[model samples]
Target: MTSTLASPDLRRRLEGIQLPDPLGFGTLMAPVMAIAHYRDGAWEDVRLDALDPLSLAPHTQALHYGQAIFEGMKAYRNLGTDLPGTALLFRPHEHARRFNRSATRLGMPELDEDVYVATLERLVSTLDALVPERQGQSLYLRPTMFGATAHLSVVPSTEYCFVVLATPSDAFFTAPISAWIERRFSRAGPGGTGNVKAAGNYAASFAAAAPLAKLGFQQLLWLDAVHHTHIEEFTAMNVFVRRGDTILTPPLSDTILAGITRDSLLRLAGSLGLSMVEKPVDVAELVDAIASGEDVEVFGCGTGAVVAPVELIGDETGLRLPLPPFPVATRLRRHMLDLQHGVLPAPAGWQRPVPTR
Candidate 1:
């Protein structure tokens, strides 16, 4: 788990920089990064270096073949606790496993769990003092892997690079989001790479999200690719709907990403005496349920925002549905936040404390 430290000048730069006020999500990056490379059929030693632009070749495989993947995670500074300046990472192992899964799906070399977790720990420990202490603020960690070899033969690259970048930021969505239902564009097909967190999946979604952004919507709700009738997921988060004492979400399929926060809330729902069900959620039926006074509450969940209540759902045809107040979502959000900040008890192995050196 050994890691090389950053240069003296880089360390001084990191210490001297001031974090700006109103820290927006993923806006302010820390001055250091963790990097590793895979070559000759093995991963090289990880290094802690200055945060700078990467020196990839103009003809790199990642640029041409689109074999890039990434993971989003957070490290929190436990507030109002006996251990001041203590940092806690949430579900590092789960993220590492997902990262390996992504790499395997893209034909890239996998990163060892020890190396993945060690890189995160080293970076968080080094920047513990810089981690925001506010309740909704945290150090957002982005671990990415991509094909690095330069070739245009439509083959997977032999060389790859893994890098972890840190950003001290606030919540991604501050208010309830309004999503535009995209009926024309498809996010992923039946046999596509939607289940994996590949970089291209997101790039393919921007064409649908851009127009919605101008229409005062925050995200695009994607429907199934084959039939275009069933609800799939939002661009970045998993979809959830609450009716009465039951919670419903689309079941995991080859075209949906299994979100970590979505899984946590489903488990918490059962503990709170709420029934959870996973099935195909038809978009038309959901609209009808809301119209028929079924008291449906819609929300989105992901690692970035944790939980976001959906206030409105609309499409280009001018059909819109306004959901009621989100009591269940608010309760679940508070409970999850409390558990993350060490105010309440978290399940065993959910939170890992960073080493203080």
Candidate 2:
């Protein structure tokens, strides 16, 4: 994949910037980014450029009306293979698929999925030196698109911009968390943008998250929007609970975001001789199961952390249930991470190796 604007200035900029120690999630950024503009319903001017701030008008459509979408992905350094410096992207097409799905839902233009993957490839290759080689660390990729037209109108903007930024970072969560059971505020409603990775969906969650953060809960286990009885998902990941010998998770509904890591682990479950079931998990039933001395565990999966075991579940009423330290979640996380880091062989098309310039 060639970038129309991959230049020597960009390479010099990359050389001058060094990766920082103790790389936090999305805190340290790569020196460069990739972008493409869409105008008159045509995508054009795709380029690899310096990671610079945008010069937008005050009436920019995205700034006012919130028509933006994004995707999270990563490129891992080969951890165990003979190729030491190899960069591998875990399920690029899957991320592209989800990105387009988000764009479709947000009334935005979708780029060619091939171009999307190629843009990522070029970006990672350009920042090959910055791809962290440590286990549980990777070059995080965030692909974002927004309405760029300077319009005060409420209708969708005619112009759009898609940008991809890279972050050299570690896993999103380092420790197991006590998830606050959110019954008061809903993350996504029935006919809302819950399923899409639009910017607004996360913005809406901050209201619920801020108070929960103060209460010392690191994460939130969101219940369904209407009844708040059925488990939907975590704020940023998909929820999986292991009950006895069977594993249960909420089925895919319009209210839940379909996570790529969640699907990958589900696909890997059968091969590991695990019984996985997809059904609506009720909060009350799960609380009862955990409180009754039954062997139950809750965990989450997403692109950032891959898998995080939920240490405790609770609500404001002082109803807290402790979960077993992740047994199934650990196994699944290790397997998937192995596949991602090239420690183990992944299925065909599951890994895409970026060519280093």
Candidate 3:
């Protein structure tokens, strides 16, 4: 409800926007946005403005050097009532920490967590009426920071800009997803930007993932860049394998995005008496186990999809992994959504409730 970068035109622009009947994932824009400029060695008054094109130099560092980082999170509405616009932010501080970590790795100034959290709360508060209340629906918030100065050389930009945009979306997974075990491409190198939600890392996925999409694959399971044998992660989600009472996931490395949903699942799995193993996952061993009649259940975890069971895993020479029902993933998935919507007990300080009049 509080903003320093208030513009009447921006508010008018947001008031004029309309959304589709079924707002698919990241498809419909919420008319309003929050933006703050960083220049002269400090961040200035952040503002709530209309979603519009930004004015940047032709040689902006983000456009050229790819110095951009972003985070995707959702805000829920109506915790105790069947009303719209309740706005519950899931584990927001962890995201704030990760955001600063990414900025430091990219050689940019770190963002203030207090400032970031406050800014998000303010934005969501003002835009509370736009938050969707339907099941499997919420306001998807995208917080992005980029170097904005005109720079040609390989150094960091002096100036930067951080913006948060929202989209009211339905469920990300309408059907069971089919993933191709990508042997040709690796999402990131050993010491690369894989852990961080950097824009370049996502752009790198397009060339390899596009081909798989052409072959009717919903997602690409990227392998290790060097060996092309170790399982890294799906292009966007963290993967987990279940063999009876044991839950196995690839340990956090420099090559995988540390998903918040993945972390929450691991935490809940511990309490549910599931043995957790975090190490390098060999893809060949995985297929071998699946073929050997191991009770294999494969699912992907992330904020967007929450928990999407993998229907099939295809590879060259016609290799497909058809997995059975994974109880752990199912239990975790239910627990996650339940807690997010106030069905189950809220974990220690997990949900940040929006103000209700």
Candidate 4:
């Protein structure tokens, strides 16, 4: 087992910190973090150190030009076992692949896949004691990379820093979420950074999400930037709709993020004997279907909220579409959670056990 480079004080900090009564999503962070630096056209040593503030120059290229990218994943403590300090990671390699894709899209250097996986394993293993044991809780991992060099020119930085931070978190959304269909401010355009997990993509969403939050909506259901009639996805999740035996989700494009949980659900839908299709979902058509009782279920999928049912979707004109009982979404969420928590046997290569040092 590889040893972590965390200082003794860092270890003490981990042992002393107590999680909050309700571990809200991304609110409390673990004591240690993994960091790797890239300089002179090469990657450097990856270290596990105490979680501390980062010191960056004021004119950091990432701050100015937006060369930052990130990924969200989770590590779950195994279920039905009294084993001390053991956990499982679901589709970590898939996340690594997506991470590299995000890096490439932003003209940034990609972390080696082996290094990415090993760093994640080392971080999870080192913090095994902090991995939440509850059903809806897990160690949420955020892997972020940013251009570090300070410059005023509009160009990629020569140096970069990649870091992985962990937080013991509950479900991102505890209840069914209400979405405000965004028509005026589009999340991403046809040939933009919509496909990548770029930091700016989320920063742009604040414009639409702030007003919706004031109106009691939980999230922004983004529409296509081109026509504003097609459903792209939510601010942080992939959207899906169910009509009877068929499961429908928007087709993958350069404008929509390819979500790992979304892919897993689509594959699991086949096992559950539900037909799955990926096509352009028109907002008007979906609204009409819901009003006519043709579409019975709507949901969103992502790493944070494995599967979250959408209870209602409202537009700017005060017209709202309410979905019926979320039978399909609920079933899929249960099955996916079962597989994640080791209650059910995981499909081949889906779950990877975290090794304890």
Candidate 5:
């Protein structure tokens, strides 16, 4: 990978761009992106360039074989932040580790963590102004890797491409969201790509999540693949439920994605005077606890969705599990956001500062 400085003309083009007021999630794209190609078993020519369409062969292996993975991250700018004018990226090294884990699972080449993180720093540093300064908005970064070879064979592609795109956006779920309990479809089974950020895992999830949009639900809650009795997670987030001062989430296994936000929350729960539990959560017990008026509050957390309270959990038959006021989630969300936007003093190496050249 190579580091090429942004020219003066490119900087002017980026500065001239304007972002709309709403700044919806994943809709608006930044003017620049970073890309690198993997060929002859080595990555080469990585550089920041214009975010333009790619000219690819018709038979790109990623198109047919689903050999692609991506990560969700964000960069925060200064306005409305405690450290004014200071830009920060939250735990980029953790994201890098997860990205490489996904790549290794797909039989793809693992990107060096240093190169992966430096690429993000270079991109955000060049386009720091594109990061939104709104309270719940920031520069959403997407780093994707795919098998770009045109061969149609079942073997792993010899060539791959890694690209990073940024978008200024708001929270994925702006308000409290309802989730549909998926019993008919399973996300993954034992020894599957459930832990990896494989593109196919999400596509397979659409069979259950897609229909929820029309049903007045915002997310789909997944259960274990073996018996469908244990709670796993959500479509794109990690699941957590609160009972009094205790927060519980399912334990990570080969069938669960170890979410970065989830880990941070578990680590921070003690500071919030909340106990943490990581065990196999049975669906029946969860439903019963909420129905018994135990003040059960459910929430989902991830990079894009961040901290979204699940207002209701229901199935197709119109059976809704009564939800309590999700105050715990709100407090936790604010705490994490404060740490991200510099309102609170973050833990050691929690937030990495960007060197704006």
Candidate 6:
């Protein structure tokens, strides 16, 4: 893979930056970023430059019309480490596939996967030391493409800019969480951008979720945007439930974000001797299962945090489902993290090591 832009100024900027001791998730930014612009019917040369505020025109289309998509991934320094620590990526290809899908859904051009992957490799290799080395620590990579042209009408912008930035941080969550089942606001409607990781989808959710934090709910369980009957996802993560040996998760409906971690979990379930089901799991059914003591565990999965077990599910009716005594979520989380950190034997081609030093 060849990078089009690499400068002494950018290298000096990277060397001059100082990161904190315990980097929090998405809090600390790497000093440099990779950017590429799409205009005039072609992708321009990829540029490596210092991380700085972007300059936008007075009427940028993305700012007004909300034409953008992004992807989140983690690169760990877990591979090739011998003494105590080794890092691994959970399922990066999954993110790549979804990222392109998001672009397609929003009327944006699909970035060539070869170019995308090569660009990712180049950036990861360049920021190798910034890859967190501790257990559960990683460099959170955010790749985003947004409309760059100015347009008053609702048409897609002809120009776009894609950039990749990294955030070095420890585990996103060291504890379980209590979530609320949002019965009022729907994250996506039928024939909407629910399945895609679009910027507007998240902006639409903030109106409903921001208020819930005051009520003490860590997150909201978004429903199917049409009828608001089924469980869709929580913020950007997918939902799952476990009953005995059978693992059940919401099906990949058009309104659901197909998570890489979700796919990895389903694949790993088989080898772990667990039965898996992918279908439209009703939120009411889940609440009933918890009330009747059938649902053993509940969790959410995404690139940020592989598995976050749900301790409570609060509803508008004052109902809360307490998670039953079972470490299925914990077990699965450990396995996934282990596979990512190289603590356990990795699946062939699941991880790619960074050659630094």
> How close is each model in CA RMSD to the real structure?
1.4, 1.4, 2.4, 1.8, 1.4, 2.2
Q: How accurate locally, in lDDT, is each candidate? A: 0.86, 0.88, 0.80, 0.87, 0.88, 0.80
lDDT of 4 by residue, 222-338 (tens): 888888988989999999988777778999998899999989988887678889899888888888888898747889999999899999889889887778889888888888887
| lDDT score, candidate 6, position 344 | 73
Worst-scoring 10-residue span by lDDT in model 5? 77-86
User: How do the residues 1-357 of candidate 5 rate in per-residue lDDT, one tens digit apiece?
Assistant: 665666676677686678888999878898789889999989996788888899889899999999999999999875434558767899999999999999999999988888888888888988888888776789999999999999999989999999999999998988899989898899989999999899999999877777887887878889998899998999899999887777889999988999999999998887788898997788888888887888789999998878999888899767788597898899988888888887787778888888878
What is candidate 2's lDDT per residue for 1-357, written digit by digit as tens? 234647988988877666787898888788799988888779886798888998899999999999999999999998866466699999999999999999999899888888888888888988898999787889999999999999899999999988899999988887788899998989888877899898998888788888776777888889998899999999999999899889988998878999999898788888999988999999999999889988998999999988998888888898878877678888887888888898988888998888877
- Candidate 1 per-residue lDDT, tens place, 254-329, comes to 8999888988887777678878799888999988888787889888889888889999989988978888999988
Which runs in model 2 stand beyond 4 Å of their true positions?
Answer: none
Please give the range of 10 consecutive residues that has the lowest summed lDDT in model 1: 1-10
Off-target runs (Cα >4 Å) in candidate 4 are 1-7, 80-85
Off by over 4 Å in 6: 16-18, 79-90
> Against the correct fold, how does model 3 do in TM-score?
0.93
- How much is the lDDT of residue 274 in candidate 6? 85
> How high is the lDDT of residue 342 in model 1?
71
What clash count goes with each model? 0, 0, 4, 0, 0, 4
Could you give candidate 3's per-residue lDDT for residues 1-357 as a string of tens digits?
224644556555556456577888877777788998889898887888877899988999889999999988888765544333467888888888888888988988777887787777877776766677665677888999999999888899999999999888876775578888888767899898999999898888888876676677788888999989888888789998887777789999888888998898878776777787887888988999888878888888888888888878888768877777666666777778776765556678788776552
For candidate 2, the 10 contiguous residues with the lowest summed lDDT are 1-10
Q: After superposition, how far is residue 158 of candidate 5 from its true place, in Å?
A: 0.7
TM-score (C-alpha) between model 5 and the true structure: 0.97
**Model 4 C-alpha RMSD to native:** 1.8
Cα lDDT over the full model 2:
0.88
The true-versus-predicted C-alpha distance at residue 211 of model 4, in Å, is: 1.4
Clashing residue pairs found in predicted model 2: none
